[model samples]
Target chain A: MENIHLENIDFEYAPGRRIFSGAAVDINQGELVLLCGKTGSGKSTLLRLIQKELDTKAGFVMQNPDNQIVCDRVYSELEFGATNATQGNERHRLELIRQRVAETAGYFGISRQINRDTHTLSGGEKQILNIASAMAANPKVLLMDEPTSMLDPIMADRVIDLVKNINRELGITVIIAEHRSDRIFAYADKILLIEDETVVCKDKRSMAEYMSRSQELRGFLPEIARSVEMSPPPLSLAEAVFGKAHAVYVGKEAPLSSHPVLRLKNVSFAYDRSKGALIDNLNLSVDGGSITALLGENGCGKSTLALLSAGALKPYSGSVKINGRKIKKAGENSAMLFQDVTLHFTGDTVDGKYNGMHPYDLSGGERQLAALDIILSKNPSLLILDEPTKGLDYNEKEKLGKRLEKLRDEGKAILLITHDVEFAAMFSDRMLLMFGGKIVCDRPAREFCESNIFYTTAGARLSKMNSD
Target chain B: MRRFENFNPATLLIYYMTVIIPIMVFMNPFIILTALAAGLVRAGIYERKIPVKRILFSAVLTAVMALVNGLLSHQGDTELFFINDRAVTLEAIRYGAVNGLMLAAAIVWFSAFSRTLTGEKIMALLWHLPKLALLISMIMRLIPRYLERYNKTGLAARINEERGQVPEKKHIMQITSAVFTWALENSMDTADSMIMRGYTSGGKRISGIQFRPGDAAVLALTAALQTMYFLPETWHGILMAVLCFLPEIYRIKENVKWKIYTLKI
Candidate 1:
């Protein structure tokens, strides 16, 4: 194993806009490194330089799965990296390439999807394909630019697992850029944080040592690690928050509305006829002045229900009443914020929020906030947000929770669909679970967190352990 | 997958090239009718249902072409009637009808061509041109995605509607600009990703287009039939026309016996 040692690296896009100045780091082979920074802190640029994709041998996996996929089919995408490595014999090249692609695809657990069209894959599958393609290249070093930034919690975990497997099983040096470090920090052997226009490199053993002095860096730590006051924080989140006291919310609960803003009665929907109805004879209602979270696993009809409630998709056989009126189409009084924030940003500059910078140039969290602002400007009675805190850091998620609280106080009916157990428990007043197209459980937020095991929050877990 | 989707691209291209030329060039009503029938038969076998609207549209176009020729061209000897000081000749109308039928037949055959040859199949045939193959497949994937995004943007606009009414002009403009920006940004990211994956690596990659024994047989059949098509005769041309539909006929028969011979996997 050979380590890549970068000494005094300097990079800049233009004059006066310094990205990295005299940045130096040594990345040992077969080690997992986490790169953390603010959105514009040149995290992607640093990764790009490390990969040297335009001029070197390092593999790169992009943040957006849809944008990263170049080939039309999965098999072709898997073959892309192995086929393009210019250093192979002409003899038996095709046979060698085929075997390499098949092996990588199988290892990535996407063997069945090889023949499937790349565009037809789900968000998570596409990200896995991106990583699989990178692995297919078989490079000594792999640089990922927030690979799990756009994935749901469940999907994000799968990507993290694959990355860990690549680091351990393949013994490839893995460097990942991520904003939310809760899931990834545990796997990282070292931490590379960009601050003060320099790369601060710390091994896993000394990361806590450094964090104790750098209060600003401590905020980037996982929720569990930030809460604990140990001199050297625990290695994993489970250790950091074990037997610790948890914060408790005791706000006076706002009463449910007498007249629901959005109502569904006997609603049933299915994308395909052969698959049967995913949402069958379901009844749900959302009223003003409270946040109601719709929680479920991936592909459990949460998004479909969100779409149906927003009137973007009409149920096959059911009544969707908005403000006590049966609507033929998506009502103007209802607004839906899609999971992809970029889908909603149209203005040049966050509408004077960013002093005329392009909306595309905004950070992920800023872009989400800007998009939500645009939707809110429409003054809709009911707001449906899908996975709002999916890839946001702890701070951004807290900011988002505050924004939701503000909206709820303004008497807006909020439907928050998310897989983040902690975020839902923090902000939502009521919780509902949609399993196999039916509302299996509906309870108050705190009560739901107390009862459920897997769907409960980190704070709940800590409190449970403390009690035990 | 369709019956001919997995057929070797080179063989499929050869078959289409051989069949389309006769449809385009030969003006005889029998040849044109047979070509049209063969195209429809093959497409029906592939799709399992004939596209009635497309066929009807072609018929309407043929009728319009014949009528236009009867009204516009007065060069023929046999006159049907005089309209606006111009002779509506029967010969001109018949000539126009045959020409129109030729055009329609060519269209139907080309539709069959498109059905048999996907962009990936084209890429497979041009495997040596890796960059071009990638571009073609990327475009093929991007188009449907662009349309889907466009529709979703429209949905977003509807969601921003006021009092159950669709958005005003300002909202529509916002939606359009947003979608355009997203498209542009997405394209740049896609290009970067492609480069990272070695799209511009200045070397060729092997396509996943395996040529089996059935493909070899089809290639041989196409080669033999193409020679017959180029021959200056009516019988050989007619034989080639029937051969054009051979794959579809074989497909139906093969499907019937598929379970008996092939394992379920």
Candidate 2:
């Protein structure tokens, strides 16, 4: 396979702010390169270039599952490229393409039933389907932009393993731009440190040295990798402790109020008459003056419960109250961000008149941020968001966490349902471990998850704490 | 496998050229019947049970459609029978039935395409095409993405109690407004993406994705079929039309990937 050579390549979206200029680099074939950078450091843009999605033959698995699926049935998506050969007819040929599609689907572990509806599948299933789809496209190069950022640990590892298989067997070159690199770190052939726009350093280095030597490298460190004696670190509680205790708290007192911000009693919701209720007889309470972090496996109804709390969905049999007031519909007093930001950003009034662009054009993370911007700017009394960390780089999530702390200081009852335990822990005073449509554990954020636990951030282990 | 049963778009077109197209243009019943029989045979190639079911379903659908058209479009010879005040002639019914069957066959045939081949694979075959095809493919990619998004959106809206019948007037206004909003946001995003990629204000140019010879050869064949269809000689015209129409067989293929893609959002 041929590789592109860059000589003094320079670029910037806005003038004067050079994202990458006078940069020369050669990326070899058949390597899984990991990119490290802070938010807006152009990691995604770089990936786009490499994947040929932007200007470059590399295939990309879209960050948002919604963006990846182009067809209705999972089988069709797999065979769509082949079936398309005989556009209007070719009935027999279409059937022939089925077995191969099914095989590829199986590679991703996608069951037969889930292939029918791409939207309804779980996050991991969607990711698998997307990867398989991209791989089948037969691109020589693959560039993944935080492909597993939002997935559960087990599923994320599975996807990584799948990618690894393709890389090894098929010799498909892979490039991954990730903030937290625990999953792919040991496996990465080369580490490219992207900081402050330009690639500061590239090539070989020990993981420990790579972690410590560069100032810009700090952002990619796993959570709880630092101990906080006085206050929590910006990324982790420990980092806050070491920086400045009083400043970390920053004139904000720990949440003392125990009043329930949201209360759901005996709630049940059914998607369709045939499949049975998705959530059944569930009871939950999220208290006020405290950052409440909700966690659960995919399809465990974490978002459903969050909706009830946010007054988006009324429980079938039970009642949901926001600060003792029952919710009748979705409106002010509360704002809920959906798992996929595109679902909520369909702005009718804002199209064509301004920039000839729809909210749909933005990437998944951008849409999420945009939705958050709209809700936060609106000054809702209770802020409810779903998978807010999705599509965001590590630094963006941290910035959002810091923003949440500021919002908390402003007395906004923040209720978040997320797959990100570190994100919730970084900001919340309280945490709830939810799975299988129920809360498995609930406790103070300070007393909550250890780094090694499920849903915890990668660098959150006590042993990994940075010693200054 | 029977050649007729192998109705992938290319084969379907070849069969259409040899059969259906001629019948349509020449107004010949023999050609149509001959092609239809061939379809039945080819339909049985892969799995015996599958083709029979496909043919049966196609025939039923076609027959139903033909019956409806015959009943409504009663301007033909009254060779068969009469129902009510309307003259439901055997000739008209036959004509309508044949047309309906064709429609049904085409629909099922195309669904078979989606079943067998995928979009990415087709794209690989068409890799050498101009940027327009790539853009078309990209937009095609968006169809399923949009459908999924819309479905999820509708569900979210329903759960949020923002969904209601409201009145036709309000509904139209809301839908129009939503569509308009969606369009604007999407365009802006495309622009942003373009700008991000250093797309200067001009026609598109390909920086990468050179076509392999295999894909180029496929494109040439496709182009040839398209040209043959456009040629106006009665027999050749018939042939080309049939070939060109083969890809339209799978109605679901034109739609999203989801087996059941409803406007849930």
Candidate 3:
């Protein structure tokens, strides 16, 4: 029997403001299921409900991971969950527990030889340790909510692969709710579409279904999904262009450049000299109306560049100008979609009319939409979005793309810093790929994705040549 | 909320002030109960900002924490009852209960008032104050929102770290840096947004918020509650409870209308 079931369930944050209504799904024992939805659609809340952690359940990774780890060192944190698991029975096999712990550590890339001191590890490493600790107890049902939204592509894949392995090996019933469908679709056996706080669609759908559908039958479509949905439902760019397709650039005077809206000249930034520069002498110029995507490997200087552009962090050297005015007030011009949607708000009130403060409190796609609201209010000449789609689902990415496109068309230059190559490739007019803190390459995002810098499940197959 | 045409903010200030400072400096339950009853009645009549779930949660949690602490910690002479060899002293336990209820009441009242004090209202009232102060106030006002977003990102980063997505090579250093950089950037973005909204243009500041007679009445009542502390302990307790309990009742009551705070958008 399933532990949780949603039978024609309808839930909304407010009455008549339906988030997910008519949501019906069943979670059988030991079943790995994926719940996908737009940011405001309530996938996370659903996971919480299923885990019976509505207030304290599934979604939260304990907001204060820094202080949450009470244990001093790394090994203790790793085995903390296992120790909790074996709280009483002295007879239960110590050897088996050790073996399990070691195996789990190996899977998560924890070294037995490493010191247990948590203070020694990096924040990402600490987070990895924290997550592994949670899995220590081996909760029969695991709810990973947008689990990899913050990771670089390679790291996200590693996590996805680990999750897939867990489902395959341990038979741990997994409920993974993620906004980005790039890594999740390949492993998901079933897709639960949550719309307006309701599960509207459930299917044993293939990535192909998502790949081929248009206008998002369930919710918002990823650009890959949208590009595929065009007549005959072309699956990739080549198909959209060459497979019964005419040049989209047909009958258009290619966009003319206005005055460079944001100019960065030989800008380089380094946290510490020994560590080297995150952005090394990067020169960039943006036309007044354009969608610019700054992409890089995880830990690369993409976000650093966003901070640089927004003037959040002073560059080690070089100059950044906004609208030909030297960048000032870093926090204002960069209405960044922080990888975590929760960090944007500055108040205690969860929901209200929120006044002008609402955008600052938005999460993921909602935050992106809120940024738009603030931008409209402020009439900013340039908008810098950092990791805009970090935790957004299929639909959210689509809405953001369309909105950013609209903003771009309206003459507001927008820079998107992201690790999701497909999002960069699909929505951006131009994409700049960063490697080891420098702009390794810059081209039209689609053209860039056509090269080796891209390789996600969607990226690999959703290319123009593949569709053709 | 939108349908209520005339909302009162003065009562909110008084209520918040009263919640923070006890209605009376005296220790008496009867007076507190009376004050609570009065607040309920007043709320029933005026129909101010509807108390939301968060306010209720804070009140309940405060009440529980207080009660639990009272039950566990206080050991004294007067015996009300005994549980597990420990005597529940009447005065000591009562002391805990009262403090707890006071806390709960305070949260409810303050939350209701807090909800009423919107950015628009503050801007309208303090527009004559230094423009920078008003702007600082707005930025400061968004502190809670930003804190929540920041915590959320940190936690999400935590989860990602566990999943093997956060690079194994760099550890948590980048996440912290990312979080810090992002927070700093958001403030700048908000500032930019404010500037973009023509905040720097020095346009004649226009405020849509207006005060009403009802608002004045709320203020008077709040001021009276605050003044009750000058009276005997009994009066203070009653006044405090009355002021504090209204928001709790408002939160529970549905489909009721009080003049909602309105601004011409």
* Listed models, DockQ each: 0.46, 0.08, 0.01
- For candidate 2, give the lDDT: 0.58
Off by over 4 Å in 1: A9-24, A53-55, A88-92, A209-219, A223-278, A311-331, A465-468, B1-7, B33-108, B127-131, B161-174, B199-234, B245-265
Q: Candidate 1, A100: how far from true, in Å?
A: 3.1
Predicted candidate 3 versus true structure: per-residue lDDT over B127-202, tens digit per residue:
4553543455444444544465555555433322223534644544554455555566555543432322223344
DockQ, candidate no. 1: 0.46
The candidate that wins on TM-score is 1
Model 2 Cα displacement at B16 (Å)?
A: 14
- Considering lDDT, which of the candidate structures 1 and 3 is the better prediction for this target? 1
Ranked by lDDT from best down, the candidates are 1, 2, 3
For candidate 1, write residues A97-191 as lDDT tens digits. 88888889878899999889988999999999988887787678788888887888778878888888888988988889886677777778889
C-alpha RMSD of each candidate structure in angstroms: 4.6, 11.8, 25.0
- Off-target runs (Cα >4 Å) in candidate 3 are A1-30, A40-42, A53-72, A87-100, A112-127, A195-203, A206-214, A218-226, A229-255, A323-344, A347-363, A371-380, A451-468, B1-265
Give the docking tier of candidate 3. Answer: incorrect
Clashes of each: 1, 86, 56
lDDT (Cα, tens digit) per residue for candidate 2, span A1-468: 846455564667878978875556666778777777665667777776654542324566645454455555665455543333222333454454455556666666665654365656777877787777665545577777777876766678788888888877777778777655655655677677665556654543454345554444545644433222222123444444455432222111244676676677888876675877777777777665567887777777877677666666667788877777887667536777676565554454223323544565554445566666655544666778777786566657766787787877777777887776667767788777766666767766655554235555433334234333
Q: What TM-score does each of the candidates earn?
A: 0.84, 0.61, 0.53
